[model samples]
Target: MPPTRRFRLIPGAVTVLGLLLALGVPAARAHGVRTEVLAGPTSVVTVTHDDGSPLADTPFTVLAPEGAGPFLTGRTDAHGRVAFQPDRPGAWKVRVAGADGHGAVVTVAVDSAALAAPATGATVATHHAHEHDHAHDEAHVHADAHAHDHAHDHDHAHTRDRWSGAIAGLLLLLLVLGVGGVLLRRRRG
Candidate 1:
């Protein structure tokens, strides 16, 4: 009786061990897909599996040229593709993939000018454009202000207030004229 019971337990244990091996091996998928854009006005890159299927739901990030924009974060759609504009206009990179396991990265090279980053740069030839001098905001750094930056936000509120004041004055004048016209009409009638 003891031998029969032990033999039954052996079959159950073997079944469990087989199940673990079968599931665990492929479950740890260290495999992946990657994509990138080549030669175009629109900076684009794509990633796919080794089999060419779109790598869906994967996270992607674009590190634009210095002083271009903040790190752009996006996920691949059904087509396993994402896009972001570079910060400046030289050697840029687009990193893509996820880390359910290890992860993957894709880098694309394109010539771009980062007019926002505060660096020594010549636009075309003789004229050197240094952007940092005029950009006085403490929050803006060298990388961001390389191109035409948001240094003029100080004037944004001022402009809005000036326009509001002008609009209000116009509305008041129109309201006064409307009231006067109504009164005149009533008197005439």
Candidate 2:
């Protein structure tokens, strides 16, 4: 093949490789999730994916400040929610595990004042403590099905924005490729 012909295939091949890589990126990524807490009459915890989907029916364990073991153990409801009544004011830890090896530990700080005024519909502050943040490594099992827990003062808009950003990125990639193709054709013809 002539030098020009051989080099002509380069741009097309590069574009093809780039497209393949871009398309495969999402599929190769592992799913990530986060958690939120609502402290009211009962301390409620909500677990959700970064994309804002509920992780329904997932198992959760709540550890009280005074206990060596779980204070309450159960699976999240369809909305990824589980609740526990704190007997005392302290830091309560809620560990939620998904089926696919993903989970989060949320630390909720409960005050005596908050517990005392539960009738006021008060919400408690929650701390994000991921599995990696643990002092010791603990083996966890993830659930395949989805579970979602409802809580107060949690926003779902962030998830929608994330999806929009991804779509915008794909559109931008297509625009760049189109312009490149046009320039290449103009150069040849």
Candidate 3:
């Protein structure tokens, strides 16, 4: 009876050891993905394999604003690096995937001010035109002043709209985190 019990324990120990090795080896060998924004409009993404070697030729896609369709698609170079210029302002998503179904998604935020910089010259020209019209007639001067005031108000409204959108996004994120935390606590309990 004692010999049989010992034999059973030996198999159980071997099974436990096998399970640990199977679970731990892959985790220890997992790779990491990293992204960096270069000067100007370029962004660089890098992928590394389990042994800290670059995973070259990995295919990647960039989506403008999260959940939007792909704006650009390409493969990484020999250094596991892909560069792209974000054309729009918002949260851009970069997705990299390998043949083995391993993938990563990283979000990069773009400032609206940066995108609007090129349009400043046009805006100044329009302002000068408005001033020229203002000098034409008394009646036209009154109209031009009113138009200027309206444009100023529109600018304020535009700024307010941007702020409101940002606040709404933040609130939604907080709500999601709160719900997730509650669910996790309940699951633990």
TM-scores vs. true structure, each candidate: 0.38, 0.54, 0.43
- lDDT tens digits, residue span 7-62, model 3: 99888977986687556544444443333332124545545554335567889888
Could you give candidate 1's per-residue lDDT for residues 1-189 as a string of tens digits?
599998998789779866864564343222434343432334555565533455777777777556356368878777666655444456556666567652356554545443343343222210112233352322222236532244234234333444455557657976999899999999999
TM-score of 3: 0.43
Estimate every model's Cα lDDT from 0 to 1: 0.50, 0.66, 0.56
Return the candidate ranking by lDDT, descending. 2, 3, 1
Q: Between the candidate structures 1 and 3, which one is better when assessed by lDDT?
A: 3
Is candidate 1 or 2 superior in lDDT? 2
**Poorest stretch of ten by lDDT in candidate 1:** 121-130
Candidate 2 per-residue lDDT, tens place, 99-147, comes to 7788888887888876886353546343332222222111111332322
* Inter-residue clash pairs, candidate 3: none
What is the lDDT, from 0 to 100, of the residue 176 in candidate 1? Answer: 100
Model 2: weakest 10-residue lDDT segment is 132-141
Better of 2 and 3 by TM-score: 2
